[model samples]
Target: MLNFERLQILQKYYDYIQKKTGVRDYFLVGGALRDILLGIKEKLDDVDLTIAGEPIGLYAQMEKEAFSHFITEKFGTITLIPKEGVMQGIKYEITPFREESGYQDVRHPDDIRWTNSLLADAKRRDFRINAMYYRFLNIKKPVYEEKKVLDSTTLLKVLDREGFVFLENSGVLIVQNSSLIDQLLQNGQMDSDFLYYLLDIQHFAYCYGEEGEKTDSDGRFDLQIVIDPEYGIHSLINRKLETVGDPDIRFQEDALRLLRGLRFVNVINQKLLNNENKEQNADPLNKVRLFDFETETWKSIKKNHDLLKTIAKERIYQEIVKSFSEGNPFGLVALVDEAEMLPILFPALAKTKGYDQPIRYHPFDIYAHIILTLWHLQQINSNYLVRFAMLYHDVGKVGQYEQYGLNLTREEIRNILAGPLNHRFSSAELMKEDFRNLGFSNKEIEEIKRYINEHHTPGEILMGNSQNWTKRLRKLFSEVGYEKLQNLLDINIADRLGMYNPLQNSSDLTDSYYLKTLVDEIEQTEGQFKKSDLAITGADVMEHFDLKPGKLIGELLQVGFDWVLGDVKHRNVKKQILANIANYLKQKK
Candidate 1:
């Protein structure tokens, strides 16, 4: 059942819509419903509803009331964002009851047949666990008493089954079975002549976890719910992942479902593992196991994995972002490799599977090293760009190793490390094309490339003394600002933890901490790493040096900027910068 606070908010919208269109047969469906049953309350800020008629007319009416809406006419869907009211910041998407067929392009339906049957809509969903629905029932207003009525044997039975909510503030008791209310009235359990006359209490029942056929002789359950037609609640309890119908037909209709199915498994399995220790005391013998793909689902994925090529790169990138945002990217990456989807999704990265590195430094092959890096990175940072940088950080080494062969002398490998600029540049160039195909903006591509370039800087600084570190660190700070440097440090730490180098030790991490301290100190004393940090600006240089508004003024400002970075104390002394630039111009003689 939905919580009282969110349910109350949803009730307001339901009342608003019912007053306008007189449509009472609608459902809260899809992921919002699935998550609520999983004991996940934080992600229920959005709601998805499937109504019994065309959504365009209702959307048009909502537009008149000044609610912003985006519609897809082909699918009869509308995403409505409320600009004002008690439901502000909550997103609501409404789709008319419809069935789909003839997916020629493997994504959209070639024809959508609108219907009043909720079962048809449930059958068209991708996964069984996502097919359940939640809807309220129509019942006479419940009689309210000043004394406690929660102890009524009839109401207690419904509440024990976990499908009812009692709104304490409004004195409205909501139950799924109207039959239970009849019993309450007959037993004279309430203090009123009639059920409390609460008009807004209509949206209160949670009709889920049962079959449509199992209802009262009056067929009241059939009227309010088509819950679990695919046995979704059963599968959810066992931690299973299976397609709603035929796996092959579903995957062929939309190949992106292949990856999405795996992402679901990965995320749900992570949640199950996290809850295992907590659940041990509650039921030691019946602890829930992690999720596994149903047998047919696994077989279908292997057969149709190649169909991913037909999907758009931008769409694929969106799925990747969603998986990474869930905080267990390594699990998803590993599952992608196990399913053989890695070769189709990232051919270059797949080629690194058996590529060897210097055994003295790396214990795993390039592919295993990359995977381990992602695992370690989760402990330090969850930024997608930081993770991506570590993924491709050593991809260029595949080509380098091929050129040198596996028999290179240790001295030759040592020389490669001394100047790894070539491989870093090569890796960044390769990442550029991948990012462009994934629809990243030009600015985002450049920022990620800069991170790739500086990935090795932290380890290099770890080898230097504090005096040399200050000079190099300040130069880097001036170039990339503080946040990017912090991200680079995170990548460096994960990379080290992924390796088995004898040259690196616990002291390396100790040095990393010192470097972080220095970064904070530099930022606190020098302020932002921009021209504003300099005591003199372009105008000041032009005025004090008698220079015109041209390139010379900009160059003289850089001179002052560099002087301040040399010693932050110089920033507070304008005369020192003027004298420094004066000496710099004299040197131009």
Candidate 2:
């Protein structure tokens, strides 16, 4: 059951609609109903409803009353929002019952025909568990006698007692068999009058099956009871999930669902495992089952793997974002690999799988190391940029390693390792195409590239002697802002943790203590190394030197700026800095 407060809110809307437009045949549908049946008490902020009649007319009437509403005639849907009522700012999407056809694109339907039948609309849904409805009904007004003289009362006498007593009752009523309500009412020993009232309405909460057959059992149970041991909705949800229609056809129609289904399975399995430790003899119905595709679904995914390539990158990106948002994105990524969808979705990532790495430092191969790095990122930070940076950080290694030969000179190896020709820059270059395809903004793409190119700089700085550490640190800080520097440091740490071996002493390449300490120092200084931190601006330089706003002033200012970085005390000595700049300019002249 939904929270009583939510039901009250739904009732309020139902009443408003009926009072304004005289329409009462509205059915609450989709995930809102599913959540209610699952006994979830969270707010059903996005309410989906199906109206038996014209939703556009209702929208128009709602608009006249100063309510906010919008209609999409393509799908025969209307979004009604109350501008000032109790539901203010809450969106309620009301669509006329619809039946669709011609799914040629395997996504949107080519034809949508509105219908008045709820069962027909229910049958058009994607999953049986999600194909359910809740009809809000007003309780019949109570009849009462004011005085004890009703036995011999005439019509006129009954009219005289009309002012004696008034009775009003309102609650949500669902359609179901009397026996079920009888069981609940009897079990709870509810009032006889309430039972009579429920019997009078003859509606109970029930879920629809794939074929639109109304069943007393919860639809979620039908799909999940096999893998989940508990009896209630939570168990039904927590257990393995299966599809309603042919799995292959479903995958072929919407390829994004394939990835989304896998993500659901990964998330649910993790939840189930967690629940097992916390719960004893847990009811399957009480378990929280997300979406789970069937075994055939997995098989269908493999068979129709090429179909994923045709799906929009935006759709694929949304699924990836959702999976990464979960606690165990690694599991989802693994499932994608197992299903062979990785090659279609992310070929670069797939290519990393078999690439070998130096075993002394990297316990796993290139691909395994990337996954481990991602896992470490999840533990340390939730920033998507950092996570994505780590994902493509070493993709260039695959191409770089292939160019290696035993006859290479020491100088050539040193140049390859230290120069822009290395994998870091190469990986950044390769990631541009993929990131653009994934709909990342140019700015975001640039940030990822910068992070990838500079991810190794922290370690490089740590390897340097203390005499040059400040200069290197200042240069690094000036290049990347404070926040991005922190992200780079996180990636560096994840990189080290990714290469750590449990059996052996930790590798120096993986050490992060010094890097963390440097981060602390940088934060304490608050980016004072940046050129912008110079006390004298370009304007000041121009004024003091009696020069125009030209490049020479910038060059002169840079000399002063370097002096400040070289010694912190020089920052406060503006007069001495200006005199030094003058002496240098005179020599240049």
lDDT by residue (tens digit), candidate 2, 358-415: 7777877899998888888877777777788888899888877765655677787787
lDDT of 2: 0.61
TM-scores for every candidate against the unseen true structure: 0.78, 0.72
The alpha-carbon deviation from the true structure for residue 397 of candidate 2, after best TM-score superposition, in angstroms, is 0.6
- Put down candidate 1 lDDT per residue, 337-363, tens digits, no spaces: 888898776666788898888887887
All models, RMSD in angstroms? 8.2, 11.8
The best candidate by TM-score is 1
**Reference-based lDDT, each prediction:** 0.68, 0.61
